[model samples]
Target chain A: MYTTWWPPITLSHSRRDQLLRALLWSCASVAGLMLVCIVAFLILESAPALSHPGWRRFFTDAAWHPTEDAYALWPMLAGTLLSTGGAVLLAAPLGIGTAVFCQWYAPAWLAVPCRRLIELLAGIPSVVFGFWGLVALVPLINQWQPPGASLLAGICILTMMILPTTSLLAQASLAQADPDALRAAAALGFGRWGTLRRVVLPSCAAGLLTAGLLAASRALGETMAVLMVCGNVVQLPSSLFDPVRTLTANMALEIPYAAGRHRSVLFVSGLLLLLLVISLVGSATWVRRALRHV
Target chain B: MNAGRAWIPLLLVLAATAGCGDSPDARQPLTKLSITGSSTMAPLIAAIGKRFERRHPGVRIDVQTGGSSRGVADTRSGLAHIGMVSRALRALEQRDLVGTPVARDGIGLIVHNTNPVGALTPRQVVALYTGGMTTWRPVSGKDASVVVVNKAEGRATLELFLKYFHLTNAEIRADVIIGDNEQGIKFVAGNPHAIGYVSNGAAEYALRHEVPIKRLPLTTASAPPAAGHPAPSPLARPLTLVTTRRPPALAQAFIAFAASSHVHDLVAAHYFVPLAA
Candidate 1:
């Protein structure tokens, strides 16, 4: 029954399985390699700062002067978290609302073009986004502050950038909701709005959570757009109107000038960013596990 | 023969992609020369690189512009053979890394050609920027509301203007800061209500392409207008070429090319004043 078909010969079942296993192993190896690279680089570059001053200073000190050997992380960390939080808060409701409309109510003509536009937006380079933000968003914020760049400007720019990612994920989540459940709800006397509110939300809960986490991750890593709009002062942001520099912006702005112990400090900051990303991803994994248990 | 001929173009393309411009001597061991920092010194360094290539041929020179402060750090780390900068080394830098002043230049202020106001005094410029004074009624000229423009941070000319004008931590209203010098100049050039500053090397588009804007001379003492003219703007700062080391050989060679007597003519021809000359 398993006779050979050609001189070249057909692949045996075992050979096929072996090939698949090889591919799977190679993919795992690639993932392992990337993780090793990030960890090694972070440890190696951060050696100078770790060796000279205690690791406590990286978390405690307030100033980042290298000459006197200060490596404070609070001001930059606060700015990063605040701006990212502001961006998520502004974009989430709007993006989810837009996705809901597109999926449940928007006409095909409008929805299709709009979806394409959002995808195109995600494809635009960070530098281009920075220029657009500098020209379009920052000026509008300056109207309120009257002559200085501020956290609000950076937030607004980020809101526009994060919209595409959030909307895309939200739409994917909405699409994953069972249409059959909606039809059944209508048969059970539930209105379109009620069905979506009750049946749709329950079914797509995991998808929606994933979408939210994905957007948050993107907001944390965004660099150039924030740098252009944020005033780039390394200080605790007192008000939305005040200028502040985010962690990523500080690293980018100072990395070129930073060396030795200072360079190591930047790597430490990068490691901190990695830790933040890992925690977020870990939370997502835990949520998925809890969903499976349910 | 036909197949081999067909492969020639493909082979050539591959060779080009694999670093065609790389010299056979790229693998050769020679004294490495690295220059980093100061985009303002790009013209001078580029000019020097061309001449140095011909003279030494064997020695490799790498010049980079990482702003002023970055140059100092790179030099200190031994990442670069020499640092090229437009700003002065800080106290730490002087102790850690040596510095040599190669040539001198004056930071020049520029305005759009269409702008009617010719010159600004040191005080008037500051007033317009910070004190919220608008409408250029220079020491004598007719009044026109002035719009201020600024370049991105870390630009040598920008750093000098801010320091000379005493604007440290002074934020420009976000509405006016442009990404690069040319854009700022273009923004001013297109609008008669705008004014900005740039290095002398950056004057071409701001002053040359259309109408040449005048440089406002800055001095502590008051100098009144000439006849029917408003006094020149007294806002000037030195243009400097900074180095991280005492000056490595190739760096010295490049500096020689930039500072040679002929280079003086070249500098002025490009609108920069060669102080040594």
Candidate 2:
């Protein structure tokens, strides 16, 4: 049984196998080590701002005037959460629905092309989306509202940018549903809609949740498109039409010119974004684990 | 296994060859000069550097842009042979480094071309920025809410704008916080009711390229513009090159070239006012 298709286990082959394993192990360790180093560096750089006597102001202060010693983080933090939340709320349902449509209902030709188009949407660089939003979407919104670059614009752009991620992941998850279960449902006289509602969706709950969470994280970390479309005012928005700035956008906008304590504060903002993304991923893992248990 | 083993040595050899080309020989010494700081002055300095390089085949001028503070830090730390600062050295900066004026630039308020407001007094400008005047109608423009665009902290233009207006960063009630002069100009040009202040040179260059934004004259109560002639920019600053107290001979030569009449055309081409001979 062992000798039928196996290549002769020569010394050179064994040595090469060991070498490949070693190479892969080193690569994996290097990636892990780099992540640790990045976390350490962020903590070190942000220590100044974190340890400052007036650090409490970061949560309480109304504005982000770092030069004036106001290190308010709430507004930008709120901006990040709100825009990403809005994007996820809008994109998840539409994306999952698109996936369901393509997987079950659409004709083969239409499904293939539609899937490819959504994947294509993922490939278009965020900067292009940002440019389009600025030149096209912002003005369109401005016609109805006074200022175009608002939280609403940011959310719309993020939704477009993250839709591909959610849809593609959902399609993959839908593809993972048991064929036997589908056949059983069909044998029991279940229609497409009934089969989808009772069997397809429940089986793919973990994957759908994972898809939504991944998209949320992507939206949270998005910088260029959000920076361009979001008016980048360091204030909590009073309305959807009001301009807002996110933590990521704030760092990108300031890091080029930031120095001294100002630079440290930007690092703190990075650390905050990292924590937010981690919590999202943690929740995703917890949900997946709970789903597996059930 | 054979193919994998064959590829390893080939990759090693390729990496070795790639590393070998960059090592300099002692015979033909390459004199590399690093110039850093001031994104505002980078284009002008880079243009001058190109002309300087053409004259000396052995020399390379590497121009980098951070902000003006990086210019001072790098010059003092000897990381850069020269640093381009868009403003005159402050008393603190002057203690460790010397700055030579190469050109002049003015910071001025810019608004969309369609905006009817012609000029803003110092008080009116302050009021608009501090949320005192929220609407353009008060400033003689159409009945629309004005969008005040402010620059982020650590920008030289922001510092100059704040200093000239006699306001602090905390005072500004900005609707949009932009990063650079180009961003400010582009933002103003895109929004009919938006007003932003940026480098006069940049705004002039933008106007030449048909970016629909106009610079408003800086007016004060003591003096008004004579008929036909607009008030000269009140927030003018020198664009200077900074070096340590004792710079190398090559650095001195480059500085002289940057300031001399030879590169005045280059300075003017960048829309900065060339220093009078």
Candidate 3:
């Protein structure tokens, strides 16, 4: 290989490979260092709250009166779970169904446009979605139900915001399904529906689940749209109609004004969110591994 | 070579962290002042700065906004010549810094004009906020559930409200939490059943603009008696300009300009009650 294509003025192949390896290693380490730094910084800043209220009380007690020294975060935690779970529950099925239609049912002309449209929806800024939700969807909800700005509105907005990503990921996964299996299924005289149901989907279960988890993460981290529509109420919502505040919303809304232990507690909330998202992604990986083994 | 390479990143991180401190070049002969902090005070400071700048042609005044804490931090660290804080300084902060009150503002409870209730006792207000009183029927004689609008965390308005009512930040059961005065007022304007609070200046402006919300006065008898304060008004607080040490000459001048009768019209124009007047 060297005899065929040695450059006149270049380092030895071994030296070149070593240099490239070093460069890549440094770049990767820098990125990993940044992640470690962020997590460490959050933990350091939140240490006071963690030690004072202690983790159990931080997780268990519902009241969050930082000024008065009570630091329970249960209400915001519940809000985060409820809204994100609601969004995922609504968006996942619709997103996967759209992907299926695009993969199998939609003609080429329709499919391309549909995918492009979904990408366009994804491109619109979250703040614009928040504004639209605030100005239009909120009032409409209010008219339908008294005091319309609610968890239901937040869920609806989040579903629309997250749908594009979920569907696009699902489509990519479905497209990557084995052609050999599809052809074999057809050869076995299985119809399109039977082949899709029996062969294509099971192989794509991990991918579809990943898409759902990614969508759920987006929903969980969402601040602006939910903040605008969710009413930012600090309560365990009894119904979708009830207003609720997510952790992200609480942080964004209060970070500027918070100081002392109150400030540390907010950082603790950040650590909680980081831990929650990491575990969620970890579970997705675990599920994928379990599926592959099966 | 290997040791030198390892030292490079360590040096870079050190440099980045230490970069914020002022360099010798920053203390040039030019008469420049940088003021940062409380977003609520930012507008007022900006206005005064413009007038001060015009009065002293060669002098430049730079203003920035984060929050009152940023103001205190900036002042303590010498990042700014002066910090603009809307709220009174805490005991810890007062140790290292001196605050000169510039203006006063009151937080007022507001409700939609469509609601028949004109006034709420302090106890009723606390009860309504704490989720104890859920419906308007028991308190206001209106057959509607109370939609308690609240301030987002970190707002001076929210802090002031909480302190006045003898409540903590978390205890208030809010239906909607809004960021700024305009958002709070707009929420109340839109929903007849909603109740919220904002600075008196903002409330007055909203009322003048016919936003369809009314400011409810706390009955004087039930209002928390003024204690350990120069002005015993439960709802009123001073907007203070702070400095870490004895302020520099330029900072002192700026503080004077902000406090004096020169900016009285400007302060009143922004809805603050002028201290001198």
Instruction: Put down candidate 1 lDDT per residue, B82-152, tens digits, no spaces.
Output: 67767566687677665556455556566645455545667776777663676567543646555566654
Q: DockQ ranking from best to worst?
A: 2, 3, 1
Please report, as a residue range, the 10-residue window in candidate 1 chain B with the lowest summed lDDT.
B228-237
Residue B146, candidate 1: C-alpha displacement in angstroms? 14
Off by over 4 Å in 1: A1-24, A51-55, A58-71, A291-294, B1-35, B47-63, B68-82, B87-100, B107-217, B221-253, B269-271
> How much lDDT does each candidate structure score?
0.67, 0.87, 0.84
> Could you tell me which residue pairs clash in candidate 2?
none
Report the error of model 2 at residue A69, Å: 1.3
What lDDT tens digits, residue by residue, belong to model 1 across residues A1-294? Answer: 477654334355565555656667899999999999989988888877777686888678866555455677778788888998898898988888888988888899999988898899888887787777666665565544533357887788888888888889889988987778878898999987898899987777777777777777888888877877676656777788776777787677666555567677878888888788788878877775676455
Q: What is the C-alpha RMSD of each candidate to the true structure, in Å?
A: 7.8, 4.1, 5.7
Considering summed lDDT, which 10 consecutive residues are worst modelled in model 3 chain B?
B224-233
Place model 2 in a CAPRI quality band. Answer: medium
DockQ of each: 0.16, 0.51, 0.41
The residue-by-residue lDDT of candidate 3 on A210-254, one tens digit each, is 999988988889998888888987777788788888899888888
lDDT tens digits, residue span B86-116, model 2: 8888898888789999988878889999989
